[model samples]
Target: MSQITTTCPWVTNDPLYQQYHNKVWGRPVYDDRELFAKLCLDGQQAGLSWLTILKRQANYEELFFDFNPQEIALMTQDDVERLLLDTRIIRNRAKINSIIGNAKAYLAYSQNGANSFSQLLWSFVGGQPVINHFNVMAEVPAQTPESQAMSKALKKLGFNFVGPTICYAFMQAVGMVNDHLTSCPCYLESSAKK
Candidate 1:
């Protein structure tokens, strides 16, 4: 008899995506650099599937200074143009520019006394992850009020490509919220951790 492996239905058998779903996605990350990187990667997923971006994430890390805001802020137009030719990442110019732009905005926020990108982001959930039990995938929403507020705040802070929908995905990805389907084996584990 063939045994079954249960996970979020959206996750396929691809190792990269499977690893992301099982080991990374829905796991809380509080590091400033990690949060910043996830936000930029989620932005790049706009109009594209997350799988498309996942395949190129290592390239993004290699090119984007591991998502360090200061280094990304220093990237020039020439750097972006050069990156556009690389196939290892999504070559969209607008997305590339948004990453550079968001890095600058992130730095400005981080420079505030006792403030950090992680703090700013975690503030949306009031320093706790919003745990939700959704029995089915359809029950999950595309955006929540918290995410809408986050998007507004990010835009006001001069970040781009951070719409409410994208913010919700970012939230789900980084464990600002627990969105695993209730029946998935990972749901309780994801909710229990961080």
Candidate 2:
């Protein structure tokens, strides 16, 4: 078997993290449903660790109707109440509400002749990954001008929980920006895909 190197400590030895790091992280996602999933997950991660949400991703998919924006937009208050009591995922009402609201906004954006939200978002970086060659994980930025602009635009479009920091995280999650550390083998691999 070939050996692979990674710079993120959390993914250094963990198989799940390694899988996500190599396969999904920094890979531009174009599908609307997947984009919505990343947005919802990132927002839910406001005060929590990524690993926690990652562990519950299956539950999220099951309960959140596979992150279909149209379905999520139609979810009712009763759905929120039921999700609150479910231990499978984060139980924050505000976060849950944000997902529903974002779905509505996303559906509207898709319906109004604009490109899908994912396309509009990827356009900020010219439909490519912004590869950063950071030697250490700490060198990775929490926010960038791109994220700031994205946050402002999302707010203008009536979305919530999309602060600059959260926007940056969303960018990372959806592969709008390639934040993989230089030492990680997948960093170069992901960049070359652009």
Candidate 3:
């Protein structure tokens, strides 16, 4: 007999998604570049499922110079055109451009001496993960006040694809808020982190 493991309902049996759920999802991430990459990747999931973006993340990293905002900020229309033909990614022009635009925006945003990109994002959550205690997936909100505020601030700074819904999802992905169900094993561990 196999020991059955319980995970958040959103997790499917697919190995990759399982791996992401078991390891990456709802885990706090404080690295500036990693946060940028995850935010961009979440943006790419705007009109699609996260599994789609997750599948292509490696390709996105390879093509986008490891999500270095400085390098991506320099990408031009020619690069966009080149990427459009690549099947490894979503191949949506607007989505692709948003990543580049976000890179430029992020570069500008981070250039401020007072706050790093990580600091700016973490500030929205009071510099710690907002651990929730929902018992089911239905209780998870699609958007929250914090996410709305984050969306407004990010857009004000010239970022694209950062609607409240997207910001909330980004918040969840980066562990700015822990959305794991209370019964899920990940919940306790994720909520335990500072």
Candidate 4:
């Protein structure tokens, strides 16, 4: 008989997905550039699956200058046109523009000096990760109050594609909230850190 392993219902048996789930998902990330990068990637996922974005992450980094807000903030229409010709990344004009726009927004928001982008983001979760004890996928919400607030704030800061649902997924990805199911090994590991 084979030993059984339990994981979040959303996870497939794919090794790459398994590695991301076990090592990266729900793990807290505080670096400013990394946070910015993840937010932009989540925005790219607005109309697509995350795996789609994940598969092209390296290409994104290459084209976007390693997610450097300063460099991306300077992207011009010419750059957008050139990127649109690339097949590795999604070719949506609106989506491509949003990343550049978001890079500008991120730079402006961080320059204001109210807080580090990480601090401002973490504030929405009371400066801690919100650990939920969900056993099934249905129990996880598409958007929460915190996500709504984050979406509103980001929009106010001139960010696009940061709707509440996308913000919620971003929160889960960056460990602002842990939406991992109790059956998943990572759930306990993540919750234990809180």
Q: For model 4, how many clashes?
A: 0
| Model 3, global lDDT | 0.91
TM-score of each: 0.95, 0.93, 0.96, 0.96
List, residue by residue over 46-163, the lDDT tens digit for candidate 4.
8788888888999999999999989998999999999999999999999999999999999899888789999889989999998998989999999999999999999999999999
lDDT string, candidate 3, 1-194, tens digits: 11336568887777788788877888999999999999999999998999989999999999999998999999999999999999999999999999999999998888876598888899999999998889888899999999999999999999999999999999998899999888888888889887
Tell me how many residue pairs clash in candidate 1.
0
* Descending-TM-score candidate ranking: 3, 4, 1, 2
Q: Which whole-number lDDT from 0 to 100 does residue 75 have in model 1?
A: 97
After best superposition, candidate 1 residue 168: deviation in angstroms?
0.4
Local accuracy of candidate 2 as per-residue lDDT tens digits, 45-136? 89888878888999988888899888899999999999999999999999999999988988888889978776888877787888887888
Candidate of highest lDDT: 3
Tell me how far the alpha carbon of residue 23 in candidate 2 is from the true structure, in angstroms, after superposition. Answer: 1.6
The clash count for each model shown is: 0, 0, 0, 0
Measured by C-alpha RMSD in angstroms, how accurate is candidate 4? 2.4
Span of 10 residues, lowest total lDDT, candidate 2: 1-10
Highest TM-score scorer: 3
Which stretches of model 4 miss by more than 4 angstroms? 1-6
